[model samples]
Target: MNGERTIYSILHILNGKKSSQTIQDIHIFQLTSLYQSFPMLSREQLEEVIQTLYKEKWLVQSLDNHYFINDTRKGELENLLKDNPLPNYLNGWKFHAITEPFWQRLSLFIQVASHLSGNSIRYIPVQRNPVTQLWLKETLHSIAIDRSNINKYLYKDLVKCLEEIEINPAILINRLTGLKKIGLTSDQAALEMKMDPSLYQLSFLAILHFMIERILSNKEDYSLLCYMIEDNKKNYTLTASTAKTYDLIQKGHNIEEIVHLRNLKQSTIEDHIIEVLLNVPAFPVHSLVSEEKMTRIKDSIEQSSSKSLKVIKQQLPDVSYFEIRVVMARYGDS
Candidate 1:
C-alpha cells in the first residue's frame, strides 16, 4: 500500500518486455490515475517516484522517451525478493532494495507505524539490512544510560560507548534522555535496539576516563572521589571480617583475656589460642578448697599427681588421681 510496494508491483507487471513499456503499453498512467482517484498520489508525486527509480538505475529511458526495466538494476532487485508473509496483493518491497538513506526512511516509517498503531515499539530486526541495524544499535546503547539504578554493569558499558565516541557528559545525558522518551531502560533499550552488549563492556574503562577528566577539571574533587571509593571497599571488608570474629567468641574461647594481655583486639588473637582448653573442662573453686580432711589430703603433694591412692580406714575414702588433677587445675594454681 506504500509507495515502495507500488513501485515494486508496477515493475513486476512490466518485467521481460523487450520493447519499452510506455505509459500506453502498460497503461501506467491509467493505473496511477485510477489509484489516485481514491486519494491517490498527486501527478507531481507520481512523477517524482518515477524519477527516483531512474536515479537508482532501476528504470532505463529509451531515446524515444519510453521507459523499461534496467537489466542490471533488476538483478539487484530480484536478489531482494522474498516469499510474501501475506497475500501477493498486500506484499510490498524488499527492505534491502533501498540504500542506507532508504533504511533511515524505514526507521522513521517504523516510528510512525508504532505511533499510529498505539503500541510501544519493542524490537526491530535489522539483520538483513546492516545499515539500519547499526543505527538501531546506537539508538539502544544511548537509551540505557539515564538512571543510576539501571544495572550497574550496563551503566558501565554505556559509559564506555560515550568514551569511544568522545562525547561530553552533557551530550551523553541528552542522548540518554532521548532513550527515556521512548520508554526504555538503558539496558533493555540497548538490547532491543540490537546493540552488542559486550561492546559496551568498556563502561569500566569509561569510569577511569571520567576520573581522569575530573582530576583535570579540579584536583580536590578527584581526590575525594578516589578516597570515597577506597573507604567503601575497606568498610565492607571490615564488616564481614568482624562477623567471623564474633563466631569464634561464641565457640567458648577465652579470647578476651588473651587479647587484653597482648594489647591487641580480640579478633587479632582468635586463631592463635583457639585450642587452649581442648582437653580441659571448667572447675569451681569451692570443690578444691573443701574443709573436709579427706578433701584436704587430696590437695596435698603426697596425694597430688599420685597414680594410685591408698585405701585407709573406711572414713578416709580414696580419691582418684583424675580428681586431684582437676583440684590442682581449679584451685592449686600457686
Candidate 2:
C-alpha cells in the first residue's frame, strides 16, 4: 500500500468492490488472486478483526488513518501461514463470478440426478436460482446420460475429476444434497470437518474453481461436468462496466472514445482497460503505453520499493498516470 491508502480500501478490496481504485489496488499490490476472496465479509466484521489486530499491536494506524503492518510483527503473519499453507487452486479474480453459478448448476444437477436414480424425483431443490432450475430442466433432455442411471455416470465423472485434485472430497461432498437429504451449510460443514468456516469456504471455492479449469481444459473427457458450463462463457470474467468497455475495445475504440461513448470519466475507462489487461490475455495494452515507455515504467517499479503511483509518476515525468497504471497492471510483480 505504501501506507497511502485508507483502511477502507482494504475492506473494499477484500469484498471485491468494483471501483477503479479497488481494482487498481488488486494489481498494484500484487493481490490479484485474493480479489473477491471474501465476498461474504461484512464491514462490522472486518472492523472488529482490524481492532483485534490493532489491540495486538500487529497493525498500526498511521496519522492519515491508514493501516500498516507493524514491522516487528510483520514476520509473525508469514510465520503463522508457514504451518498452514494456503490452498493451491484459488484464482478468485479469474473464477469468482462463475463459482456460484457453476456450483449451483453442479449441486442442483447432482441433487436431481440422485433423486431420479433412487426413484424419488419429487425432492426439494437445493439450489433455488430460477435461472439454474430452468437451465437444468432444459438440459436434462439434452444430456446423453440415461435418466435411470445418471447417478452412476455423474459419480464416475465427479470422482475421476476430483481424484486429480488435492483437497479432501468431504470439503465439497458434505455440501451436496441428495434424495431425502439436505446438505450442510458452510458453517455446518466447517464444524463437521473441524475447519474454520472462512477456510472451509475458501477451500470449497478453490476446489470448484479447480474443477472449472479442468473442465475447460478437457471438456470432451468430462462430459457430465462439462454440461454444467456448456453455455457458461456468460461473461463472468469481467465486471459489468469492464465488459462494456471490453466490447467497445473489441470494436476498436480508443480510451477517449470509450469515455465519450459510455459517458463515464476518463479515469473509469482507464480502470476498465486495466481490468481488460489483467483478465483478457493479449488485449494489446502495449499500444496504450508504447514499449519504450512501458520499459521505463517497469524499470521504475523494479528499482523502487514503493507501490505509490505518485512516487513513480515523479520519476517518469512524461508518463500519464493512466499509462503508469496500465504499465503497472501489465508488468507489476504478481
Candidate 3:
C-alpha cells in the first residue's frame, strides 16, 4: 500500500488499542517511533503525509501537541484498514533499511551489556550509534544501583525487554549470547521457538523497540533518546565492496593499485572509496583528494542546479569522478 494509506492504518491500530481507546490522542513522539519501523517512507516523507492528513481534516492536533483522528473520519479510516491491512513484511531493501545492521549490532551489544557485571566476556567496541555509549553507561548505572544484586537487575531488564514476546526469555538470552551451554544460531533459535526465521527477526526488532521505548519513557534521563536514535542513521557501516576497498587502502594501496589488485574497474574502486568515506568516519579522504580540488568541486556543485555527477563533471572536466565524489562525500549535504 502507499505511504498515506499505511500511515492511516497505523493511526487506526494505535487508536483501537484498549489503553489508548479511552484517550484518543496519540503523542507525536510515540507515533513517530512506531512509524519509523515501516518501509517506503523517509522521515521527511512521513512528516509530509502527517501534514497532509491534518490539512484534510482527517486528523487534528490537540493543545497538548498530540494527534487524534477526527471523530467524523475515524470510521472511514477504520473501514479502509479493515479492507486493506498493511503488508506483514516490507520489500527486501526496505526491510533491510529498517532492521539489519542496527538491530544486529544492538543484539550483540545487549549481550555484552547484560553480562558486564559477571565479567565473563570482554566488551569489544563495534560500529554503533554514538549515543549507544551514553545509553550503555546509563543502563550500566541503572543495573548497578545495587552492586551486590547486579545479576538480578540485568535479568529484570532483559525480562522487561522481552516481556511482549512469547518465547522464554532465558532461551532468547542464551541464543543472543551464544552461551556455551546453549549455543544456537538465529535459525536454530527460531526452530526451537517454533517460529519462522523471518518472524523471529521481527520479534527481535520488536524487543529492541520495546527497550528503546522504555528508555525514551524515562523522560528526565533519556530526553535525548529520540534525537539520538534518529542521528544514529549516520553510523551505517561499510558495504562489502567498500570494506574490501578499505582493507586495501589500509595496506597502503592507491586507487589505481586497488583497481588492479581487486580486478575492478577504476570507476568501481572510486565508488567504493566514496561509500567508505561517507560511512566510515576514520577513512582518510585527505590522502585521496587534495584540499584545493575539493574546494573547486564543491563550488561548481553549489553553482550547478543538478546534483548528477555527469552535470557537475561537465563543469569540471579536469576533475576526475573520484575527486568529485570525495568532495560530494564531504559537502554534499551542504
Candidate 3 ranges with C-alpha deviation above 4 Å: 1-234
Local distance difference test, each candidate: 0.35, 0.83, 0.54
Per-residue alpha-carbon lDDT of candidate 3 for residues 32-98, written as tens digits (9 for 90 to 100): 2233343333546556777898899987775333466888997999898676433232222112233
Best by TM-score: 2
- Give per-candidate clash totals: 3, 0, 0
Q: What ordering of candidates by TM-score runs from best to worst?
A: 2, 3, 1
Better of 1 and 2 by TM-score: 2
**What TM-score against the true fold does each predicted structure earn?**
0.18, 0.90, 0.38
lDDT of 3: 0.54
Question: Residue by residue across 131-155, what tens digits does model 1's lDDT show?
Answer: 5556545544554333232234333
Task: List the candidate numbers ranked by lDDT, top first.
Answer: 2, 3, 1
> Clashing residue pairs in candidate 1, if any?
36-40, 144-186, 156-203
